[model samples]
Target: MVGRSVTAVCLAAAVSGAAAWAGTQTQLPRAKALAFGGRPVAAQRHRQRQPSARPGVGVSMNVHEHHHDSGERYYGPASKPILDAVKSPADMKRLNLSELKQLANELRWETLEAVSKTGGHLGSSLGVIELTVALHYVYAAPEDRIVWDVSHQVYPHKILTGRRHRMHTLRQSGGISGFAKRSESEYDCFGAGHSSTSISAALGMSVGK
Candidate 1:
């Protein structure tokens, strides 16, 4: 059973939908934004740049030399669902703790595969892999919102919250979005792109509530 009192502090419950990405695109209403104290709410969008070949795409988690101990992420494309990886927030809840840990590894592996093809954030995803799994396992999706910042780390969020099938379409035109999109799912509440907007967005949400 998941700890009731909780051991680690966390982000919110981010879930639902697929986003369509374009060149150096601004991603608002489709990523980031969430409540404090790890309360689950719908996410806001975060518009940001997604240039082709900026850096840190497709690199392996263990293969890279830079700060692997510091938790380097590998958001590269992986072999097509060769494994039965969790694809949604509910999916995560259905698994046992041991299973969840394995799922996290696969998510990272899949993230590596996906990001490599599209060439986006990798390190952040790697660092947050365990955290993402725990959140999904704890909260129900489409209700709770967990905002991300500099949100290229959205890879793991996408896979767990029901966008695994579209992994290959990441960061592509007329494909999937790189940032969180409200249109994509109710899990997204506010939009973001630049930094310093996440906490404020969450605060506004609390006031509105």
Candidate 2:
């Protein structure tokens, strides 16, 4: 909390990027929610900051070394056609509600196996699976910019748009980034890491026009 003459700044970090994707970030005023103590109006927002370069790979665990099951049916580059077939919001939109559940399932298993090997932000990314799918289903990528705050949750986003096969190479010294990288993806609108800042950046883009 940052306390000034009249107001206080509170910082919150939600692990759900899926919720962020749902276009459900609206909220009531803080003044109305909190009990007021004599003070001034505080200007508060999440400021994007450079991420602390966390070193060290995940401690290798061989909990299931005895039996390895690699029998997985995966779509190859053929998925590119399916991805290309999905262009606009109307195209990606789910005609059936069941697809959200299916997307969630796919994201979970993929995330677990990937992060199990790579060991990044496992919990947050797993939690937001539904939200990510919903957003992709609703918004047209490369055109409707989606800025991810605290970019960890973006792994699944990367996977769905066509990075599924790269799970084994995640976070390597010279591999796919653990966060958004312009070189890695065109889907990433603005790369960021911090508690929050997406809305502000989007506002700037809006004002740029």
Candidate 3:
């Protein structure tokens, strides 16, 4: 009887340990999700299980690693036919929603290609790709005065506003200034390098206008 009882306890302990191990393995992805922004574990699991609508269409968020090693630059086209057609913000206004989406992808690729060679504030520029497209599409620059704070983020804006050709000369001594400059282009209404200055500049422009 004692032998039987001992064996049963051992079996129960083994089962419990196995269950715990399995649970830990399942929770690993959720743990990674929490590291991003403390999202709930269940939501993370649900996202993991969900499939992407279009496979192989996702653009990599990471900056190109080749820029670190290669001396040769990427001089090829930044995007497909959609982006190639966009010469100015007025051109963007003509695009439908689907075309605009395609243009955004192209703009992103172009921005990456330019920055990969010249080396500028790539992250901020990339983060605002969609916003830059949207703003240019909706509002008229040079006239509307779309003042940008931390103008490091304005690479995409520059690309949309007829500065794509000069992107290769970015941040050089005689090249384009990395930050917003009214003299550089009329699209850059306010020139600022610090943060929290856009609101004041916008207000000043509003009053001045």
- The number of the candidate with the highest TM-score is 3
What local distance difference test score does each model get? 0.53, 0.55, 0.65
Q: What's model 2's TM-score?
A: 0.57
Off by over 4 Å in 1: 1-85
lDDT of 2 by residue, 1-209 (tens): 01111111011333254355434432213332221221112211111132334665333311211111434222212223433443333555753555455445556566766786777887567656666667667566666666776678778778876777776788988778888777788777667675466666666666665
- Candidates ranked by TM-score, best first? 3, 1, 2
After TM-score superposition, what is the CA distance of residue 204 in candidate 3 from its true location, in Å?
Answer: 0.9
lDDT of 3 by residue, 149-168 (tens): 67788888888888889999
In model 3, which residue pairs have backbone atoms overlapping below 3 Å?
A: none
Candidate 3: lDDT over CA atoms? Answer: 0.65
Candidate 2 colliding pairs: 6-40, 18-131
- Top-lDDT structure, candidate number: 3
Q: Which scores higher on TM-score, 2 or 3? A: 3
Per-model TM-score versus the true fold: 0.60, 0.57, 0.64
